[model samples]
Every structure is written in structure tokens, then in C-alpha cells.
Target: MVWAGMCAAIDHLRTHKNGKLIIFEKGGGFGGTWRDNVFPGCCCDVYSNLYSFSFEQNPDWTHIYPNQEELLAYLTAVAQKYDLYKYVRFNTAVDEARWNENKKQWDVTVVVNGGKDSEYGSGYTVTSDFLISCVGQLNIPKYPHIAGSDSFEGKIMHSARWDWSYPLDGKNIAVVGTGATAAQIVPEVAKVADHLTVLQRAPAWVIPRHDSIISEWRKSLLRHVQPARQWFRAESMKARESFHEAVTQAESAKAKQMREITLAHMHKQLPDRPDLWKIFTPSYSPGCKRSVLSDDYYPTFLRDNVTLETRTISRITKKGILFQGQESETEFDLIVLATGFETFDYMHPLKVFGRNGRSLTEIWHGLPRAYKGVTIEDVPNFGMLFGPNTNLTHNSLILVIEAQSRYINALVDAVLDVKAHGKHLSLIPKLEVIESYNLDLQKTLKKTSFADPNCNSWWKNSEGIITNNWSGTAVDYQNLVSDVIWEDYEIEETDGSETFVLRRKASTHIGRVNEETHLSTSTLRSAFVKCRSFLNWFCYSWNSQVDTQYEQVLKLSSDSEYNKPSRRLET
Candidate 1:
């Protein structure tokens, strides 16, 4: 999808005569997370309405939860429709991105096909005005540090890298971790495997997932009357947003209702086994970790062929897994680790060097922090799509990604405007402003369920800091990025010599991008028309309005300045 978007962006720029856009992909394929996690039963947890891009709503989604292959296909289709394949350079990993203060461009180093032994090749670097890091959180798989792991004679594989060639049929499988991946894989494997012993260090609270194929007639209705679908999407998002609020807020009616529903569901599922229920039910409030939804997970436990071992495994012996209390070893033909990704180590595969020759790793040694989860204070001309604190426990990620795209595009426009006006440029967020924003975030997080000490989730770091998730609802984040507060940023002018723009108060016109004036009225109108083509490709109410307004603004070229206001559009 990133590749496709990049291609579309580049094509749009080319057609409209905007600016250049280059995309670099580390892997041989485009789909970010979809390309990586090929585990069995891996699918989206969020409803399809909330999960998909708001601009490109998929009316033909087979189920509420789409599997990896379907998602990959959808992304591919999106790319194909947008004609974005040309801009993407696959099998090339970015090694470093160094910001040149003098040149006002990023020197990005990339390692292409840098594989092991004879397969390895030389690396190269490229320079660009903007840098976008779309490397998702779940790209790198996390391996458990079990003793004598290598000593195991049986076939062992991480869930992310599921060896499809190896057969699991009639085999004794010891599946570790009862997280999202495990929940899906267990039921599927139980149908085939002779005996499946699932090692559960911690049990997740599973909710009913009534996933079914939507009727063709219903899909047709959705396609025809998109407003109805849009309404459904809005309501679903609103419900999720409300859920987020309930989780964050101390004691609310919604929160109480949620608790009751969860408990009721739990009781309904595991009526006979309260001991299992006790372990499964979280002590801390819901939304501590990413809330999982699954109807089949609990019923899968009832199967006589499967066993959920609550006892923690001490080590991996030569014969089999050794539990803390068990004398008899549970031997296995195959061991599958369903442990999740290494999220903290973002872009670990590629080396990125920013200002002062400092690596991103060095900058964020203990805790990763970003101003608005997109830009770092020192990292200039670089934007992160799924950056720190942007991960949602309750809402759709596509909304976050789209917001990021808009924000970054605005920054790009600012950069281009500066260049066109014969001015050198650099944009950096104010330290005090960033500190204040983070301080508020910390305060808000302190009042949330994630801050509960009883809950130890991957959302927090080793120091127990909530660095992954946003402190509030998605709307709060959207509001934060709604406008670029110029007072919160430092702009540098370097046409001849670098000079800092004088610090101003919270004024409306602070560091506003200069309006374009070279193009004729007809040419401007034509450009707007070309830009509107994207709207036709991905029709949404927001895009439709934006296109119409943009065309109108172009037609009234004399009043172009009115549209180039200091404040960003609320929509």
C-alpha cells in the first residue's frame, strides 16, 4: 500500500507539476506488515469498515476480519488502480538518512540485496528533500529466550515465519504464547494435529467474533449508497472511540457497561472452568493491552485433543519442553512460538543517521519519543507514518496513517513553496513546545488504564513507560494534527546564509508558507483539475469537497491568497 501510495503521489506530482517523490522498500515486495507476517490464521482484528482506508473503502470485503492474503491483494489492487508501481524500488533497504544543514536535503544510504554470504551485494545512497519511514511496528518478529532452544531436534518456527513446507498433520505440536496469533493458529492446528499442547504464559480476554461473508446484494448496496456505508463506518469508529474514552477515564457508565459485558461473555464461555477463567480474566482494567476479539478461541479450549497448560515452561530440553511442575515432559514433533513483534526496535534492519551524526537508536536509547509521533526535534525533512505513540488500542490505524499523509504533504508543500520563492529551508519543532506536548501526554496517560501497574503489556517499555499507545482517543490526536501551530516550530531561512526566523508569539501568521504566483490563472486551473483526478480514483466526501474547493480556488486565482491562510482547514 505504501508503494502504491508513493507511486500515486509521484504520478500526481508529475501530472500536476508539483514536485518529485521517491519510494524505497527494504523487502522485495510492497505491502509493509502484510509482506512480513505470513503466519497461519493471521488477520485483522478490527472490523473491515474501521480497518480499511477511509478514502478507499473496500465494499467487497469477504469477512469482518480480513486475512493477510486478502489484505495484500487489496493493497496490490489499490496500487494498481492508483498506477503507483513505477515509483517503488523494492529489494532495497535504507541504511542511513543524514540531514545536510547546508544543502537542506537528506543523504539517504541504502543497502540493496544485502543478504548473507555470496548473495550479499554493495549498498548505495540517494539524496531527497523529504524522508518517509513507513516501516511498521510488527515487521520484526520477537523470539523467546529459552534455554536449549537450539538443542531441540524437532522442527521449531516463529509464527511470523511459518514454514508451510513442513507438515503439522498428525504431529504433536507445542504451541507457545496465547496471544492474537496463537488464538487463531490453535483452532486451525487442532483440527489436524494429533495433540496440541498450548503453552500459555498469559491468557488474553477473548470476545465473540461473528465473522461471516457479506451477501452480494448488501455489498452492492454499500457500493451504490456509500453514504450508508460511511455512516456505518462513522458509528463503528464512534463506538470504538467511546470505548477508548471509557478505558482511559476512571469511572464512567460506558466503562461499567463494558466491564459487565466482558464479564458476562467470560462467564458464558467458560461456565464450567472458573479456574481457567480466573487466569484468563485480567486483573487490570480492559484496554490495558490491545483488546482481542474471537468467538472460537474459548470453544477451542473445550476440545479433548487440545490442552491449555497454565504452568510456565522452565526450559527446552533435548526431548521436549520442561514445565516448572510437571515430571513427565510434553514431547512435541513441532514447536511454534506465537510471540509477537519487537516494536521498540523500529527500523532496526536499516540504519538511519540524522543531525550531528547521531543514529536514531542513540537518540532513543531507553524510551522512544517523537513530536506528534511523526517528527523528531532534530530530525529534519523526515516523517514517520506509524511512529511512536501513534499505535491505537481501540481505533483504526488507517485514519492515523491518512492524517500523517496529510500532515507530511502539507510540510512538503511548505518545503516546495520555500524553494520556489528562492528561500532555503529547515523545519524543527520547538523544544519547549515538544516538552509541553509530551508532558500533557504523560499526564493524560497517567489517568488511563494502560498506566495500571498490575498490567504488564508490550505497550510499555522495560522502564514501564507507555511509549507505544496514544494517551487519549483518536479524535484527540486528530485535533492535535488538525493545524500546524507555527509557534511550536522553528523555521530557518538560508537563501545565502542560514538565519533563524525571529521567535514570535502565538500569532496566526507565524512562519506561514509564501503563496505561489508564477503560474497563469488557466494553468493553475488545469493543475487543480489534474490534482482532482486522485479524488475520482479514491472517492470520499472529504476528498470530493477538497477537490471542489481546490478547483474553485484555482478558478478565482486573484483570491488564491485567501486559501493559503496561516491556519489549516478544519476538515
Candidate 2:
């Protein structure tokens, strides 16, 4: 699934399963990024089977990968099925959020309909017992800082904010940047545009998508047979899991194999054009930056109407783009800036103040850090989804979102349990907990291909610290946040009493997988689990006993005993 839309599912689950959740969506609809990014050929790289929630398996996928429209339809269906619209305030944007110490609530400032003059449309403040931030990283678009960008007389558009009203047929177009978004847009634009020029700073490693249509019979079988769907999802997830080594270790055998596979795919596509091959190949490792999965991106260059330009753009003129060394500029009818988003600006443009009036942005100082990518050290009663160090390069983010939603639900339960006794509560982790945690995390990240010095990427900060991705595999991160250690927090209650202490549950609520399980073992176990689920369905029982097993391992300690926090990084 697209990473931004997962928050809607989390909102649905929380309302039904946990608290009286209220959502503040900045748009008029449900789908987040899927609703915003409607560029040509916009689709997910992950397979359709594994891109959805485990409980909501879609049996109507037409292709192996679903496009933006289909994914948005799925999210809209989910919101309607769960009646989440009643709880959502549409066209509402959160401007600022501050903690009230006495009331133990969040005073949120919101603007309705951009503060227009409509009925009940204006800026106001609302109070809530708890606050959760689901504004994902990819929401804001990033534009290039080229000189004289305002002088362009023709139509200019960012890929994220495409203008559908503009015509593309029989027009001369120029597309800048060769990232994932550009990889998808170039092929579709090339089919209709009279002439297309692809401006690139550096080339990306390309691989075959191997996408195919799912037959009607197969879709029916998957819908009717419980085992068939489970097995399909498991197989797809297992294939994606193997890519962890290829993306993490630069010198590993898996990385070498990935480079060879990418090179072979590129060679087969552009076999006759030896000069273009050198222009397309990258000098860095395959996993140093995000790789492109396509069967059409390379072949688009073979068209007689297309040209690939690798020169640096000096400025934007009234006619077109101007290269650094050239005196003249090439003219175009339209300019498509396929530049990506501002990924590192977490919770930006929204001010947040914590305890003692501490600014969240100032605290981060351009390096956003959080414990387990969920909660900050000084931010009490506030939980953030898709926070720091939670992005993945090799797998779908739905897995991470599932784990984080469960963890946040646990924190909410703890706070509500205290309120049940007519008392107020606030909890924050010790400062040293995240400090030591990130220190060990960065130590492991330096050894991965993401931190390779050959290429720059959105995964790191200006200081070259990897502030976007997790240090280990998706499974490794799932294990780390499987359980919340209550003893690690500085819990406080009202009435000037210290008698409240939350009891640990025997097991967490989410499904569990063993840390040492291998690929072959997981494949075999999935078969048995699917068969069991199929049999239980016939018996009119819907128990996930074989699928959902929670791990419970926690030891309680006093505040003083938990002084020096030291938790070993698993994997």
C-alpha cells in the first residue's frame, strides 16, 4: 500500500477496537497520498496481495500491482465499511498542538476549509485527552531550487500535484529528475507527447517488474478459498523479505547478485544502443539509493522522439531549461518536475510544544529522533505514526504501520485505565532511553548500503545521519516493538499520589513470528496455517489461532532500579 493511506486504516481500527478516535483530515476525502498523487502511471511497487491489511484481503485486484485509483477506491471502501466518516472532520488542518499540564489534554489549533467565509468554516481550538499525528512524510512536495524558475512562461507542474486540465497529447514536454516518480511518468508521457526530453542528474538502477494480469478464475478461487489468499500473501511477503540483505550489506553476495540482475535487465532492454547504456547505468551500488522497478522505463528511450540529457540545469528561461555550459536554452510547451517530496520534514509547518513549553522543532534541531519511531522523550500523551527511522527500502510499510498502531493502542489503554479511577496521567520515556537506542542504531546503519558515501539520498539528514530508515529488517523492527515496557516510562498521576501502576498483559494483541524462522520454514508453516484456516471456515469458526500468536516477555522494576537504561539491539 502507499505509506500515507495506512493511517486511515489505523484510524478505523482504533475507533472500533480501542478509543473514541477523531480524525482531522486536511483533504475532503479519505485516501491520503493516494488521493493527492494522481500523476500518469502512478502505482505501487509492492504486489497487490501484500499491500493491504492482513484482515482485509482484496480479491478483485486486476493486476499484480494496483494503480492509484484502485488503491484509493480500496481505502474509500474501508472507510465506508467501518463508518469512519462520522468521526472524521474533513477539510480540517492542524496548525499547532500544545500540551496543557493541569488538564492533561492537548489544545489543538485547526483551520477549517482554509479559514474561508463559509458557514462554520474558520480557525478554532479543540481539546482532546490524547493526540496522535498521522501526517506522513510524503505529503509535502519538494521543488527544485533552480535559478529563474519563475521566468518559465509555459505550463509547469509538479508530479505530486499534477494538473489534469492541461493537455499532454501532441505537445513538446520536458521531465526533470529520474527518481521513482519520473520512472513511471516518462513512459506514459512519451507515448503521446510529440517530443520528450528527460533531464537527469544521475541514473538509477532498474529491474524488471514482472507484472501480469490476474485472471478471473484466479480471483474467484482466492475469494472462495481461504487458504489460497493466505498462501499468496505469504509467498509474496517472503520474496520481498529476501531483499533485506541485498539493500543492507554493500559487500554481501546478495548485493552482488542484485547488481548483476539489474545490469542484465538493462542490457536486454537497450541492447542495440551501447552509448545509451553507459548513460543509463549508475556508478554507485544497486541499493545505495532507491531502485526503480520497470519493464518500460528503459525502452522509452529507444523512441525516435525522445532524448536523454544529463547536463546540469543552470536556470529556467521563458522558453525552456538552460544547461550550465550552454548559451541557448531548449524550448518546450510543458515542463513536468518529477521531483520527489520533502521526506525529512516531520510534523513540519505545524508547531508543537511539549512540557515546560519546549518546541518540538527546536528539540529535534533538524535531526528528528524518537524511541522505536513512536513517541518522543519529552512529548507526553502524544503519539506519532510513521515517525523517525521507520521507513523501509525492501518491504511494504503496512507491516510497520500495523506494529506501530498496536503499540499506540497499548499506550492509549494505559492512559484510559488511569482515567477510569477519576485520575489524570502522563507518561514519558527517560531521555537516555532514546539516546542510547539511536547510538546503537546508527552504529549498525553505517555498515549498510543506505549509508554508502558514493551517493546521496533522502534517507539521511544534512549531517549524513540516516534519519529515515530502520537499522534492521522489517521483522527485526516488529520484534523490537512487540511489547511495551511500562517500567521504562516516568508515569505520573494526579492527587499528588504515586500508587498507580499498570499491570502487564500476558501477551500483546498483534500476530507474532519467530525471530529465528527461516524462509523455508516460514513457507511450510504458512501452508499448514492456511489449511487450518480453511478448515475452520467450513466449521463456522473464524479463529486466527494458527496465524496470530503474541509474545509476552517483560520484567517489572522500580524507578530507581531502571536508572541506567541499556537494551541490546537484536539482529
C-alpha TM-scores of all predictions = 0.84, 0.88
Error of 1 at 167 (Å): 0.7
Model 1 lDDT vs. the true structure? 0.69
Worst window of 10 by summed lDDT in candidate 2: 549-558
Error of 2 at 420 (Å): 1.2
For candidate 2, the lDDT comes to 0.77
Candidate 1 C-alpha lDDT tens digits along 1-571: 3532443364336444534666777667667777677777788888776777666788888775788898888888877766566666677777778888778888888777635511655677788877777776776889989988999889999988889999988999989888778888888999899999998776665655656665565566568766546655654554455456546553655455556656677788878888877878777766676666777777777888898888888889778888898887778889999888888876677677776777878877767778898777777766777778888877777767666666766666666666776776777777687788778887878778788777677888867788888886566566567566665677766764433233333433212111113333344344435544532233343244334322221222323222244323233
* Number of the top-ranking candidate, with TM-score as the measure: 2
For candidate 2, report its TM-score. 0.88
What local lDDT score does residue 29 receive in model 2, on the 0 to 100 scale?
Answer: 82
Model 1 ranges off by over 4 Å: 1-18, 114-121, 496-571
